[model samples]
Target: MIYRSFLRPILFRLSPEAAHELALDSLSFFLGAAPIRKAVAARHRGWPLGPIKRFGLEFANPIGLAAGFDKNGTAAESLAALGFGFIEVGTVTSEPQSGNEKPRLFRLASDHALINRLGFNNRGAAQLAENVRRRPPDCVLGVNIGKSHRVAIADAIPDYLTSFTAVYDVADYIAINISSPNTPNLRELQRREPLAELLRALQERNDELAKDKSLRQKKPLLVKIAPDLSEADLEAIIEVALNANVAGIIATNTTVSRDNLHASPAEVQACGEGGLSGAPLRSRSNEVISLIHRLTEGGLPIVGVGGVFTAVNAWDKICAGASLVQLYTGFIYEGPNVAKKINQGVADILRREGFKSLDDAIGCSAK
Candidate 1:
């Protein structure tokens, strides 16, 4: 209520990207002090519902801050103090790039959505690793990697491998992002042959690196997919994912589609050529999570993300088969308290629904 009634009005007045940077910078400064960070964490951390164990890591809660929110790993610890169980940072490319031209991020206020073509902009993988090393988050950390813009589609595997190697030692898991619409031809990597090859190569490296480091467990690998795939495409991608032995699937990135929005067509079209995310993406993302759960028979772990804005939205995804739910656009609209509120709501709902644990509630709606 405070955020929406007071803070949001002032923050929303600035351009979307500018507001985002300002928020991040403010969090970084205020939370940079250890004592202040701890105080904030104490106040906001959700109740101690049982921890969620997925991909060999135990999450304090199922709600995570999705990738793209902290593209450079800056303010990650601050974000964690805000109550996210985990923080997936980066979509960091192997090379540093300025990204698409300015005015690339647009807000469809009426729709409570955003459209962005910010093309994997970051300080590059090496710098991100350094950032994480210097100020690791308070919770689990997943590093999301993408092919460098300069890298050709054909050379994507090696490009991704470079990033994977850089962040491997620090990340709790790695998210292979082949789905951002902002990057030209990136989604094409989702095609069966290429997708399979990419996952297989990454898995092989994961094994080698684990062995070389003498780590007891290999780092989990997850693939993030686009929301625009056809049924057949989804099925094929699932087959490839299973074949590659990846640990999990992040059921969505964002959508290129702009259907059924409350915003004027002209207003939306003006934001042109970018991925759309937020309230408009909820149903389709839930549908994709349900389909993956049904198809895999709940065999593969799923991280559901899209338009999640409240606890009910997160619960919908959990019941649709997502073992964990993440938020990006939702965090923007709902404010910093979103994760703590959602986590508490989920625990309440679990008991109300007569479920003993979250795992027990997974896919209840689908069943």
Candidate 2:
């Protein structure tokens, strides 16, 4: 009520990226105190949805802040105070980057969507690891890693491994991002042979790190794929993920397709080429999640994301087979209370449907 009616309008006046930075900065400054975060989390508390364990990490709720929101781990603890079960920060690379250019993020207000060609802009894995170590969030933290923009396709494995090893200790789980259409030739790594080889090398490194640290098990490794994949592409990725023994799949990143949007082609085209996210991405993302669930036969955990704004949207993804649900654009459009709202609504929906637990609700709609 407050966000859409009051705050959103003021924030909307600023450029999307500017508004985001302001909001994050405000949260970082204001909620930096532990006492304040406790109060905020208390105020935002919803139905007792309880903790959810997936990929060996336990989430306070199923809703998480998807990667790309906090490209660096700054403000994570403050954001965690708002009630996210977990937060996935970065598409960080081994090397730091400034990303595409000015006006790279555009809003399609009518569609409640955003198009971004930010190109994995961040302070690099080492810096993010340091920030996270200094002021880690209260909830689970998943660090998302990608190939460096300067790195070539042939060298992707080593490039990714650089980031993989950098954030290994700080991250609760690691998400390997081979999707995002923003980076040039990055998606080529998603091809079967390359994808398999990459995951294999990373897992081997994961094993070594666990042993070195005297940890009982290697940290969870998850793959974040794209929505535009064909069935064949999805199958090959899934097969590779399972064979590599990854912890889970993020189901989607963002889409290059501009189809089926309420925004006119002229309006969308004006934003130029980039990955489209938010409401326009919901259907395809859900389809991908359902397909991954079916392909894995409930064996591999899936994180469903894209276009999730409310409880109903979250419930839809939960039904479609997401063990965990995440949102990026939805958080942008909805405001600070989005996570609490979705969490509350999901609990209500679960009760109305008489499900034993969230696990029972998983894949209920997939066929």
Candidate 3:
């Protein structure tokens, strides 16, 4: 309430990207001291409600900070203190890149949405690994890897492999991000043959690395797909994922579609070509989640990640098929208490709906 009524209004006055940077910097500074960090954790870390075991790792809760928010792994520890079950950092590449020119992130305030073409701007994968090694997040940490903008389509596999290897040691799981519209030709990698080859190569290396490290468990590999894909495309991608033995799918990244938004055409067009996320993305993301759940018979774990704002929205996704949920724009709009509020609300909804546990509620709607 304080954040929405007071802080958000002040922060909203700044440009979206600027506000984001300032917020991250402030949080990082405050969390820099170990005492302050622990104190924040104690205050914000909500009680363990219903824990979830997915992809061989146990999540303290189901709400997570999505990849784009902590692209470089810079503030995972700080973010973890705010009650997220997991924090996925990076759409990191093998090499460092500056990403697109300024004014790339836009806010659709009236619609509760954000459109970003920030392009995988981050310090390289190696740098992120070093950051995580120095101070890991208290909860599960997922590293999202993407193809370097400079890397050609044909060499994408090796490019991604380089990034995967760099973060493998620190990441609890690795998310292959081939869906962001900002990167030229990145979505092309989501096609049938390309997607299969990519997952196959990564899983094979995943096995080798785990064996070499003498670890009994290999890091879970997940693919984040765009919401723009067609139904047939989703099916093919699911087949590829199953064939490659991938751990799970993060259904629906930001959408290229601008449909059903209250923002006018001119205002939206002024934002230029970037993925639209937040409330406008909710229905489509849930549709995709339901489709994946129905098609897979709830066998594959789905980390739902588009347009989730409140617990109702998160619960809708959970009932539709997502085993877990992640937030990006919602965290931006709803303030730091988003996860705690959502987790508490979800627990209430589960009981109200007569569900015994979070696992039992998964895909109930789809069924």
Candidate 4:
């Protein structure tokens, strides 16, 4: 309540990117201390049900901070203390590079949305892996990896393979991001030929690493796709994922299309080009989730993203077949309590609806 009514307006006053940096820095500063993290977590324990087992790992809660928020693995402890079930950090690359120029992130206040062409800017996988290794957080951490902007499309496999190995030990699971519109040709990897080679290579290495770790388990590999995919495109990707034995899919990432927006042409045009996310993305992303759920027939796990702003919105995705839900734009609009609220509300809805567990809510609408 206070976030949209009070804090959001003030933060929205600044440039989108700058405001994000300020908020992240402030949180990081506080969480860097032990006492503060414990104090914060103690107060926001949320609905402490038993551990949630998904994606071959246990999540303390179903709500997680999406990729692109903690792009450097910097403040997992702080974010976890805020009551997120898990925190996914980074769209890191094999090599570091400054992303697209300034004014790349824009706000569509009228639509309660944002358009960002931040280009997956981060400190590269090696640096991020080191950061995670040095001070591992207590909660589940998934690392999202992408190709370096400089890497050629043909060489993307090796490029992504480099990152897969780098963060293999640190991340609970690896999310292969093939849908960020900011990077040129990144989505091409979502195609069948490229996706097959990519998933196969990574899984081979995943097997090798599993042997290396013999003591520990092999981390699951998940692919994140765009919401704008055609049915044929989706089928091809699904076939590849199943054949390659990939763990799951994150459906979907931001969209370049600006259709069905509440913002006027002039106002939306003013925001220019970038991926559109938040309320405007809710239905389309949910549709993608449903399609994938049907395509896989509840066999493949999906981590839903895009436009989940409230408990109802999150519940919509769960009912449409998302095993777990994540949010980035919603966190920006609703503030830190978004995850806590969604988890608690889902628990309430589950009980009221006569569902025995969170799993019962999965695909209720679609089924």
Give the root-mean-square deviation of each candidate in angstroms. Answer: 0.7, 1.0, 0.9, 1.2
Please identify which of the two predictions, 1 or 4, would achieve the higher TM-score against the true structure. 1
Whole-model lDDT per candidate: 0.94, 0.92, 0.93, 0.89
Q: Is candidate 2 or candidate 4 better by TM-score?
A: 2
| 10 residues in a row with least lDDT, candidate 3 | 43-52
TM-score, candidate 3, is: 0.98
In lDDT terms, how accurate is model 2? 0.92
Candidate 2, superposed: residue stretches over 4 Å from native: none
Model 3 spans > 4 angstroms off: 47-50
Per residue, candidate 4 scores C-alpha lDDT tens digits across 75-185 of 776888888888888999998888998889998887889999999889999999998887677789999999999989999989998999999889989999999999999
Cα lDDT tens digits for candidate 1, 85-188: 99999999987888999899999989989999999989999999999899999999999999888889999999999999999998999999999998889999
TM-score for each predicted model, relative to the true structure:
0.99, 0.98, 0.98, 0.97
Worst 10-residue lDDT window, candidate 2:
43-52
What TM-score does structure 1 among the candidates reach?
0.99
TM-score of 4: 0.97
What tens-digit string does per-residue lDDT give for candidate 2 at 237-343?
Answer: 99998999999999788899998889888998899999999998999999998988899888899999999999999999989899999999998889899999999
State the lDDT at 172 in candidate 1.
Answer: 98
Q: In every candidate, how many clashes are there?
A: 0, 0, 0, 0
